[model samples]
Target: MTTNSTEKRAVRTSVLRASFLYADGATRLTDKYHTSPIKIAKSFPLKDQLAVIVMDASPGLLEGDCYELDWQAREFSHAYITNQSYMKVHPSSTSEEAMGSSISQTFRLGDNAIIEHMPEPVMLYKDAKLHSTTSVHLGPGSVWMQAEVICPGRTLRNEQFQYAELRSSLSVYYGDELIFAQRQRVVPGQHQLAAPGCWGEMTHMASFCLFTDQLTSSQIGLIKQLVDDLPATGDHQVVVGISETERYGLVAVAASTAAWPLQEAMRYLWNHARNIVLRKESVYFMYS
Candidate 1:
C-alpha cells in the first residue's frame, strides 16, 4: 500500500491491513499487518462472527499525515470493523504550506461474506483540511454495510463550517460492474452550503449504505417506517431520506443541526438492515 499524501516535507505515514477467514464454525483473524499510530486494538467473537477495532494512537490527524487501510473477508466469513474514537482532523498552520491529511480505505468481500464497517463521526477543526476515499469490491451473494457521519467543525466553539476544505469519495463495484459512486467537496468559503439545494440549515450529515442481495420489498418498507418514527422535535429533529440504488443496494442520508440525531438515525437503519440481511440481532458497541 502507498500513502496518498502529496506533501514535500516529512510527515507521518501509516498502514493497517488485515484479513478474516472462516474455518470450522467461526470467523477468525487469519492475517494482519499494521504500522505506527494505527493498529488492531483487539478482536472478540460475536457468536460465529468477529468484531475488530482499529485505534489511532495519535491525538488526531495533523497536516501532511496520511493513512492507508485495507481489509479482506474470505468466502462465507463475517466481520465487523470499527474505530475507537472520532476521526479528528487538526487544523493547518496559516504560516506554512497546507498539505493537509488524507485517508484511503479498500475493502474486498468474497462470496456470501459479510462486512459491517461502522466508524465514528469525523470532526474537522477550524481551518482543517481532509481528503478521504473508500473503494469496495463485492463478490456474488456478499453483503457490505458502511455508515459515515461528518461534522462541519467544532460547533461548541461556534466554529461551524470553518474548515478550509473537505473532499470525500466512495466507489462500490460488484464484480467488474460499478453499482454506486459518490463524490463530495465542501469548501465553506467557496460554496453556500446553507442554500435550499445544498445542505440547507443542517450543520451535520450522515450516510448509510447497504449492499446485499437479500433485501426485499417488505424489508425496505420496514426500514422506511423506522426512519419515519424518529422524533422531529427540538434537538432530536432530523431529516432523513432513503432510496434504492441502480443495483442491489439502498442508501439512507440524514441531516440535522446536531450530530446526535444523525448518528441515532443511521444506527437505527444499520441495525434494521443487519437483521434483514444477516438474520442477526443488533450488537451495541461500547465507546470509551
Candidate 2:
C-alpha cells in the first residue's frame, strides 16, 4: 500500500578507479556495486575506450531491488561491454516486499568514439513487474556490438513468471540527434503470449545485435547465411534482420532461444560474427 515500508531497503553505488598509461593497461575494473553503485570513475588510457560494464552488486536481485548505471566516452574513445550472465529477478511474497524492480541507463560516446555493449538477460520472476530503458550515443568512425538474452522464468526449475509485467527500451543517438530505438513490453496477465500473432509458440526469448563499420564481402556472405538458417516456421523463428544506418555502419540483429537445433544455430551465428573481427589479417585499432 506504500512505496516504502518496514522492509529493509538495501542499495550501493560506486565508480571504480579508471586506470591508464600502464603498459599492461586495464582491460576492466569492477566498481563493486554492493559496496558502491554511484559516484564511479572513468578508466583512463581511455584515448580508445573499450566497453562500459555495469552489474548488480549482489549475486542476484530480489524483490524491491533497484539498480542504475551511466557512462560517457571522450572523443576518439572506443570500448566493448559484455555482461557476466543472465540476470534473474527473484519473486516477491506476501510475507514481505512482494515486489522487485530495476531502471534504465544512459550511455554516451563522443566524436570519433565507439562503444560495444552486451548485457546479460534480465529475467522477470512470476508475478513480478518492472521497467527498463537504455540510451546510447556514438560518434563518427566508431563501432559497437551487443547481445541480450531473456529466459522464461528458469526453465530448468519448472518456473514461470506468470502474472508479471515488464517493459524495456533501448535507443541510440548520433550527430547530436536521435537515430534508432526499440522497446518491448510483456504483461502475461492482461496480455497473452499465445493470443494470436504474438509469441503464440515459443517459450524462452532473446535478442542480439552487432553494430559496427562496413563489412567486407566475406562478412556479408556470413551474415546472409546465418539469416537463411532461421527456422522456416514463423513462430519458431529467430527474427533475424540486418540494417545499415549512418551511411558508414551496419547492424545485425537475431533473436532466438529454441531448445537444441535453434539454440545451436544461434551459437553458430554468434561465432561467425566474432570470428570475422578477431581473425582479421591486418586489422588495426585506430586510436593506438
Candidate 3:
C-alpha cells in the first residue's frame, strides 16, 4: 500500500486474494476476492483442479500503479495460475516526475499440495520503472514451481534497455527457513548488465526455481545435464545453465535477445524436471 510520489502521481492499485480447497477428490476455488483492474477466471476444462487465468482489465501498468495478489492451495489440492498476455510497462513522465510501479504476490502451499505460478514475459517500455516481489511459503510434502522473464524493451522498435530501472526478487520458504532466493536489480546505462561476465549482449533473461524435497546427487546431475544439452540455434540464440541449490532445489537461468527462445528453454527444463519428480509426464500448457 505504500508508494512514492503519491501527490504527483495517480495511484492505481488492484488486489486479488483466492484459495483452493480439496474435497470429494477434486479441488475447488473456495475463496475469491478481487479489486479493480485485477480479475481471476477459471475457464479451463479441469474443474477438479484449479486453472486460473489472471485478467488485467486496465490497458497496462502506469506510473504509480501497484498490484497485490495472494493465492493459497489448501492441503492435497493443486493450483495453476497464468496470465492472459505479456505484461506491458509503459513509459513514465519526466525524469524528476517519473513514478515507479510495483507488484507483490504471496503464495501459501499446504502439505501435499502443488502450485504453479508462471506468467508471461514482462515488456518494459522506454523509461519504464518497475519493481516486483514474489514470496512462497511451502509446507511439508508440497511442491511449488515458479519462473520469471524480463525483456529490456521492444526490439523491433529499437528500444533496447531504455528503461529507467527494474528490480525483482523471489523467495521460497519452508517452515521459516529460506530454501531458495533470487534477486536482481538493473538500472540501464548505470549498471553493467551487458558486460562479458554479466548478460553480455543478451536483451532478455529468465530464471526458474523448483522446490521439492530430498533429491539425490544423481538426479541433480541429470537436471544440469539436460540444461547443458539444449540447443541455442537458428536466428534466436540462447544460453542456459542449471545447478543445484544448497537446499536440494534446482535453479536454471537462460538468456536470449528474443523471448521465444528463452521460453522454449524453460519449457524443456520444466518437462524434464517434472518427469524426474513425478516419474511420469504431466500436461503443462503455456501459450501466448
**TM-scores of all models?**
0.93, 0.67, 0.92
Cα error, candidate 2, residue 52 (Å): 7.2
Which ten contiguous residues of candidate 3 have the minimum total lDDT? 41-50
What does candidate 2 score on TM?
Answer: 0.67
lDDT values for all models: 0.87, 0.53, 0.82
Residue-wise C-alpha lDDT for candidate 1, range 1-288, written one tens digit per residue: 875454365667899999999999999999999999999999999766899999999988998889999999999999999999899999975534677899999999999999999999999999998999999999989999998989989888998999999999999999989999989888898899988889888899999999876678787777767777875557556888989888888888888888877777777778777887778887767232
Q: Compared with the true structure, what per-residue lDDT tens digits does model 2 show for residues 20-87?
A: 11124433433223234322332333333444344445556555656665655555555555444456
In model 2, the worst 10-residue window by lDDT is 279-288
For candidate 3, the TM-score is 0.92
Per-residue lDDT, model 1, residue 159, is: 89
Clashing residue pairs found in predicted model 3? none
Q: In candidate 3, what are the lDDT values of residues 201-254, reduced to their tens digit?
A: 888999878887746687787888887678666887888877778785888888
Scored by lDDT, the top model is: 1
